[model samples]
Target: MDTAKVVATFSVGIAATLTATALQVGKPSGWDELATGLLFAAFLAAIVVVVFDRLTDANHGNLIQLAFVHGWTQERLLKELQAATIAAVDANSWVLTAVRISTVAQVGISTLSGIVAVVSLLT
Candidate 1:
């Protein structure tokens, strides 16, 4: 689905970015800062993933997301989503806005973690 696309694209982009950075900066003389940055990035990613995974859950997540669907029938689910898709389309502005917001928030949190790791390494 679109969400997965966004996630994958962002991940690849970030990985590319980090690779370029590592090449330019080379490994630090000591593990102190690099370790710190890794820890920070991991922690931030973990927190964001937990939050979003909860949102993605079928039960006890967003009520509006559940209400928009007519049923879980294959035909209905397929109608909202193309084959091999994991997300449904919503015409509602609010639903779209929420998804976009969630995407940005997840990215922000993951970036924060990477930043922390870098700063720790630098120090």
Candidate 2:
């Protein structure tokens, strides 16, 4: 239900998937090693997100309580409470963005790696 929890959960899940894939995807050739490296990068980036989420959640408790007491109504408070502060929210947004970019990068790298492997085989 909480954003931080969601982020942590997803990050952990991604990390687990990446680690498993990397372990299972044995390198048949050099290009495959490169792809494995990209997967590892994704796993590391996801781990960074999980750490950031924990830090953000730890610091935002007071802000959330404040928003609860000061916000005008339940619905409005719920919306506002989504962000503890503009700066923190922005930082978290950046973290999420980084995670997504890392994920995309991993996929792109994997695709290219596959292409290289195919090309190598053909040659």
Candidate 3:
């Protein structure tokens, strides 16, 4: 929960801020409307996923921590990691998901901004 909240809080805040700004100042037509809709949807999804992830982590992380601390010895940790590869998987999932999502959103914004700029120029 803490980890997810740590990630989600800032992300949601940023998305809310960006979508709100886009809604206010975005171009009136052409691709702007579509861009606005997609941005707003993504913002909403970010909020939802952030909340869900935090709730999920809050419930699971504690148990995992406890298991690691008391139930698992160093040898066991090594064996478990070797067998299930959980830690590596979690790290990889977190890193990849964050990077991929951010990259996609960046590209989306750049594309929409380019569309708006071109349309603005033509108009």
Candidate 4:
């Protein structure tokens, strides 16, 4: 999750740089415009991923805190902890899947944007 956040942050920076360069090229061709749009989209997507991951982490932390607060007896606390563990596993699985999909999307869009930018420059 931390790695995903780091990569997403890096991707956003790259996307911004690419978009700025595309805009500065002056009198962009259709391909340059397309590259800029795709870079913007990629940047937005990375931001969303980072936000969603942070939210999910906060929610899980709250859940764990609630479990400790509510559990009265030793047995109850153990049970609560076990339940929290299961829930965490499920949530982490889903989060990992989402991160994987978003990472693939970011990479694909960034690659395509780079290609289009290069083509625009060459033509």
Candidate 5:
């Protein structure tokens, strides 16, 4: 089994379990509530990334094949593709930055939220 896929699946399973527990327990502390929201957002972001990546992969393969058929050198094709604009941002950076930022934010906020939730529960 792919380790990364297994870990991702585990992460999602944990999130779902926590969500269900949170719903069944009475009103959660603010920290718990925030954590749940962030987890939900993180899941949504994952879905969006998967969809966008699949869409781009389709275009990426086609572009490479087209370039090959036209006798364009790999290096030149890569340079042009990297410099190309997608949604007004550099093709290479736009989606990547978005996906990275969201993932980082999700992880950071989730950690912070977890800490706060633990403290709140202890107090």
Candidate 6:
């Protein structure tokens, strides 16, 4: 999770830098404009990852709190904890999947944008 956060953060920064570089091409036509658009899309994807990550963390925290709500025998508490754990995992699976997909897209798009920006410079 920490690694994902770091990578997403780095991706966001790279997208911003590349977008700025693309814009520096003055009129920014052809590949330069496409690079800028793709960079913006990558930036939005990274932001989505960040938002999903925060929501996942919050969900986990909520599950933890709900699992330990006092009152109940040790056996009952264990059972409840197990059930909550399973339910939380099931519910959060999609969110985790989204974060993974968004992170991959963000990095991939940023790399492509960087390449396009370079190509624009050469052309």
Q: Give me the candidate number with maximum TM-score.
A: 6
Question: What stretches of model 2 exceed 4 Å from their correct place?
Answer: 1-55, 58-88
The reply for model 4, stretches above 4 Å from the true place, is 54-76
Taking all chains together, each candidate's TM-score versus the true structure is 0.35, 0.38, 0.34, 0.72, 0.45, 0.74
User: Could you give candidate 5's per-residue lDDT for residues 10-122 as a string of tens digits?
Assistant: 45456555555554556667756766776676566545444444123224665677788898898978865664435234444566666556555545444544454454455
lDDT of 4 by residue, 76-122 (tens): 65666677677767767877788878877876787777777767766
Per-prediction CA RMSD (Å): 10.4, 7.9, 7.3, 3.9, 6.5, 3.9
Considering lDDT, which of the candidate structures 3 and 5 is the better prediction for this target?
Answer: 5
Residue-level lDDT tens digits of model 1 in 1-123: 366345734753563355335435655544334544544554455344444432332232333355356446656554444522334322334455655665565566546545544553455
Q: Could you tell which candidate, 2 or 4, scores higher by TM-score?
A: 4
After TM-score superposition, the amount by which residue 18's alpha carbon in candidate 6 deviates from its true location, in angstroms, is: 3.6
User: Once model 3 is optimally superposed onto the true structure by TM-score, how far is the C-alpha of residue 35 displaced, in angstroms?
Assistant: 3.9
| lDDT score at residue 120, model 1, on the 0-100 scale | 39
lDDT for model 1 comes to 0.47
Clashing pairs in 6: none
Clash totals for all candidate models = 4, 0, 2, 0, 0, 0
lDDT of 2 by residue, 1-123 (tens): 145345544544554454445445554555445545554554565455445432244245665677668765766665565654655667667667665665555444444444444443443
For lDDT, the strongest prediction is: 6
> What C-alpha lDDT, on a 0 to 100 scale, does residue 121 get in candidate 4?
67
lDDT of 3: 0.50
On lDDT, the stronger of 3 and 4 is 4
Superposition error at 66 for model 6 (Å) = 9.8
Residue 121 in model 3: shift from native, Å?
A: 6.8
Cα error of candidate 1 at position 78, Å: 22
